[model samples]
Target: MNDQNLLERYIHEVGAHLPRRSRPDVQLELRSLLLDELAARGLEADNPADAAGVAELLKEYGHPEELAARYHTEQFLISPLAFPAFRLSYGIAAAVVTVVFLVGLGLRLNQGGLDLTELAGFLGSYIETMLLNFGVVAFVFYLLEGLGWIKPAKTGAGWDPHKLPAVKDPDRINRTELLVGIFFTIAALLVFNFVPHWIGIVSWHDDGIGVVPILSDQFLTYVPWLSALWVSEVALKALVYRAGRWTRRLRLAEFALSLASIYVLYTIVQNAVIAKLAIVDGIAKFALWILLGIALLESGWQLYRLLSGKANHPLGVPSIRENQ
Candidate 1:
């Protein structure tokens, strides 16, 4: 290729990856730089370009992706200011998607019995859901950043160094645990309400396919209360995230939720037959009993901690005296 053609090709490749707003200026600057570099190397642009020389010059300039990367001053979707929020949102989304997909797969296998066609359809739908959600989250954050709605915590006129609190024990309000709770609660609510069909089993016989629901029809009756409980937990977690510390009120709220959840579990487990799998009916009942036992133990633990004051440090904000 001639020198002009080679340079234009290189410029086009680089420009392809650049943002449309800055592409024209970037291309012009890149072209000028390439021409200047060639002149410095004593390669005449006027002559038919040697393939070897063009290759060497492009190599020195770096790969198109690397060159384009240097020009990216702004983040593609999420700015640094909104990164923590974006991470939390994406994490919750990912967790919900995974749980829904797994639940759907399990139900399909248990109810209809598995076929390759069904499995492929489920996988394709899962991938599409994940990609769509990821794009939506990223675009929302990008729009927020573009509109100057989410500024860095330390920036802007309202921020004050003097108002910053002293560092307390890092154990207070475990962010990771809170995030996990929020994710699972949201996932459970989604599966229970919007996608109840995903909680069943599929079986295959010589003649046809059969579907058996894992949850009893009565399970639907508890969904509204269960959903409310989950929504409250999410709200509490959001408050903790905003405050960056756990308060006494939050601890009390959590304790109340735990108690309510234990009660709900008790009522649900009393039915003895939540799932109707022919082979695993006994095992499923055993699992529900085990879950009830765990909830009881958790409630006892919470009560003991509340009374003994052990839960104060982990779930309560440190006092000013404690910080000293």
Candidate 2:
């Protein structure tokens, strides 16, 4: 009821949640700090010395939630999963112990509960073994973290919370970068298809026509290059959904690969079928032109992102709120 009692009660409440090894010392330090804070506030008026008045003052000072939270460290020396919340570690420990206990108890029960007079002897044996194994597992996880096998992610001190830039909804990803992806798709088609035959690596079979190989005979032998071309095309499109400097350039590289693949596919198909090629030649040429048109437009867009330099340093760090 008095100042000392109120501080003691607060200490007892917090100490109950802490590890037994440090509880006494933590309680004493907290008790002294609380008293000091009250004295500084000059709440030492006559009734302030009274237990009820002290209780009200302590209540006004708030539960030491902040003090309690400090005990929960982001220390890499402990399991990332472990914390001041003993229940996290205890639940796992207890569950393991419980399972072992249950198995032992079941085996004994199945033997017909025959040990009536010496029940404590059997019970003690079961608890001891189960707890020993449980403690081993708990300590192993702690030690593994302490040994730096499972490293904790950077937080607090490593990251400059104050340096974080402000976020704006309007500053959503830049629109021009999306155009780069479209451009790459087109450029890929032209580079692979329309290029002069002075660079034909391999002619498809006997036919004068030959399409480029996408996967290559050494790679898969039969799968057409068109498949890889299409796949890369789709992937490039997907990458555009993300707006970032590095990703933007990676998208460009993907586009070039896709285009070269298309060229190889065209040559492979052209060399494989000579008769039907005439029928498909016009259609293929038309497709390449359309792709080139799109590519030109996209190139202009990419140029804009590069000139603006936004593409050069695209935001690498993600927005935390989005992660949540």
Please name the candidate that would achieve the greatest lDDT relative to the true structure.
Answer: 1
lDDT of 1 by residue, 269-294 (tens): 55434555545654564455556556
lDDT of 2 by residue, 1-324 (tens): 332244554555455445545555566666567677767766542343454555555555444443444655543433323433334556667666655555554445434443665578766876786678657656776776567664323332343222223322222446566667667766655554454232333565866767553322232332336546755765655565554434547646744764576466545443443223444444444444345434544566565654544443222112334223
RMSD each, Å: 22.8, 23.5
Clashes of each: 9, 22
TM-score of each: 0.40, 0.27
TM-score computed on alpha carbons, candidate 2: 0.27
**lDDT for predicted candidate 2 compared with the true structure:** 0.49
User: What residue pairs clash in candidate 1, if any at all?
Assistant: 110-201, 110-202, 111-201, 111-202, 111-203, 112-202, 112-203, 113-202, 113-203
Positional deviation of residue 61's Cα in model 2 after best superposition, in angstroms:
13
Compare the candidates by TM-score and give the number of the best one: 1
